[model samples]
Structures are given as C-alpha cells and as structure tokens.
Target: MNISPTDFASLLCSRLCHDLLSPVGALNNGLELLADENDPAMRARCLELLADSAKASANKLKFFRLAFGAAGGFGDMVDTREARTAIGGLFGDGHRVELGWMVEEETLPKGAVKVLLNLALIAGDALVRGGRLDIGAETIDGHVEIVVRGEGPRIVLDDELRGALGGTAGDTITPRAAAAHLARALVTENGGSLQISPPDAPALMFGAVFNAA
Candidate 1:
C-alpha cells in the first residue's frame, strides 16, 4: 500500500480527531450544564465532570504528540520514561486498565518509540473490557524488539486494524487503522517486520523487530 505523505498526515489527523471527539464533546456539554445548574451540589458535580473531561483531553493530546507527531527533543533518541508517563496518563485516569512496563532501556530511537506507542494504543483499544496492558522493548545485537500484550475477559481487534498492522490492508485502509499502518510502515522502513497474534488467540499481542542502529 502506497500513500502520499499528505494523505498519511490527513489520516493521522482524522484518527486524532476521532479519539478526542468524545472527551472534548463532554467538556463542552459539562460547561453548558454548569452554566444552567442552580443547585450548589449539582454544580459541584458538574465541575468535577468538567475537570475529568479536561484531564482526558490533555492526556490524549500528550499521547498523540509522541505517538503520531514529531515530539520529544531534536535528539535521535527519546526517553522511555516519557513514553511510560504518556501511556499511563492516557489509560490510567479512570483506572479501567492496568499497565505493566517491562522496558529497561533509558532511551530508545525515535522510530522505535513511535512504533511502541502506536502498538500500545492499538492493544489498549482492543481491551474493550478494560484489561491489563503490558508493553516491553529492548535492543539486542543491533535489533530493536517491541512487544505489547492486552489481556481481558474479552478482546476484540478489528480485521482492518489487523490487516493494516500486517501491511496487507491494500486499498481498504481507513483513518481508524492509521496508527497500525504507521507502526507497520515504521518497522518495515527500518528493515524489520511486524507480527500480531491470531484473531482467535486468547490474548491480543503485537510484535515488531527493527534495526536499532
């Protein structure tokens, strides 16, 4: 699948907007309710809801900056701790999901970081029932290996996303699967490969191998 840089950027923007719509919309609605509510206690609850929505909006922007934009410093490597914080913030506010960080490297190449973040995003979404997400990455023998696992009572991965991750989406690509497509593109461009667990598998998992040097 070949896409122009402009088209790819548009797809990413669309995906970001789609993910942010709910929280942003909630923020708007909360403000309207707060303005109309006269009861002190109810107004307090509205304020709380507004705060929660604001936090969610901020978290999603932070996550997208690193995952889909040219964030971090000008250096070739990005701090893994930043990645951990971004992931935690995006999925930890409501405490619906658990995160397990297994990477020991202090910093990773920007390409690897983006791939890891995007994979984590996909895995986190697959855990529709709010499950545990484990993310790990390491560089060994000039190769960077990334893995993300999502476990829950029920896991669902859309076929389009699976195909996009495997680099077989062909002409059926959509904005929703843009992150998976980006992950595959980054790995393949770095002379590596991407893999995903079978759809029937008990757990959803993603694996990628790319040159680190």
Candidate 2:
C-alpha cells in the first residue's frame, strides 16, 4: 500500500481518464455523425446522444472532483448536498443504480467527504448488474462514520480494490484501485478504520470511521 506521492497521483489520473474516455469518446463520435448525417431524424438522434454523453462526462467529473481532486475550490469543509448531487448523477442514470442518501450533516470536513465519496463509488461499482446503493454518514463524538451498501443480483468487488480499501494492496495497486487506496490512506491518516463485507455475502458493504476532531 506504500507508494510515492507522484506515483499515486499518476494512478488517480489514469483512473479518471479511463472512466471519462467512454462518454467523451461518444461525444466525439456523435459530433462526427451529426456533421455527416443528412436525415433530420438521424441528426436529431445524434444530438440526443451527444447530450447524454456530455451529461455523463460532466457527472463523472463532478464525482471525481470531490472524491479525488480539490473539491472544486471548496474550503476545508464541503456541503453534503454537493456530495449527494455528485453521487446521484454518477449512479442514478436511467435508474441503473438507485441511490439512498442518509447523511444528515449539512457539511463535513474535506477529508471525511472524500472518504465517504470514494467508498460510495466503490460500493456503487460493485453492483455490476445494477441495484441499490445506500450511503449514510454522521459524526458522533467528533468522529466521522460512513457506510455504503450495495445489494444486487450480482456484486463484483474486485480483489485489488478490496485489498486497497483494507490497506493490503501491496504491489498490486493499479489505476482502478486509486480511489480505494486514497480512501484508506485518508481514513488511516485521521486515525480511522475500515470494514468490508465478507466476499460470500449476498451484498457488498463498506464502512469507514475517522477522527474529525
């Protein structure tokens, strides 16, 4: 789990680029088709596709900004509403994954928010066949606790990612695990602990707790 800061940053950049490539590529392809199409109906379809792609790209960027970046210039604390919006946009598309946000705090420390978002991202992705993603967070006695649960017909939590979240990825860390590594690092830095549901369980759940005092 130990890596140079520069290398870790490169991994995060790779992950962001990989996730964005699909929608961004679709936008480029749609624009090209719109330029060449003669039929009005086909042109309209291309435009619709372009719009969807743009929205998807934007949503992913927003999620990553909070989960991995500087929170879009936000201060030491970030509004919970922004985190909710980002998660909704990332997983609420076409109801592929339903989101249930239960965080009551209006704002949380930046480190806590990042941990929450990254863990939610991991849980959401585990629902390979689409399902429910419930995220809950709260502060008790100056400590932040976050829990993300994903239940579906099929859940796929990559071993590397699980290891990363548990701070045991060792030399197998990759771009796909960048978020998990970062989450674990932040939690540990703040004297926090993480928990992952057993692999045989029907659902995937992640819980994190860190000192926010």
Badly placed stretches (over 4 Å) of model 2 are: 72-75
Error of 1 at 123 (Å): 0.6
Q: What does candidate 1's lDDT look like per residue over 100-134, in tens digits?
A: 99999999999999999999999998889898999
RMSD of each: 1.1, 1.2
**Model 2 per-residue lDDT tens digits across residues 1-213:** 579999999999999999999999999999999999999999999999999999999999999988999964755888999999999999997858988889999999999899999988888888888999999999999999999999998999878998898877777588999889999999999998999999999888898888985
lDDT of 2 at 156: 93
Quality of model 2 by C-alpha lDDT: 0.91
Over all chains combined, what TM-score does candidate 2 have? 0.97
The candidate that achieves the highest lDDT relative to the unseen native structure: 1
lDDT, candidate 1, residue 23? 92
Model 1 regions lying over 4 Å from their true place: 73-75
- The Cα local distance difference test for each model comes to 0.92, 0.91
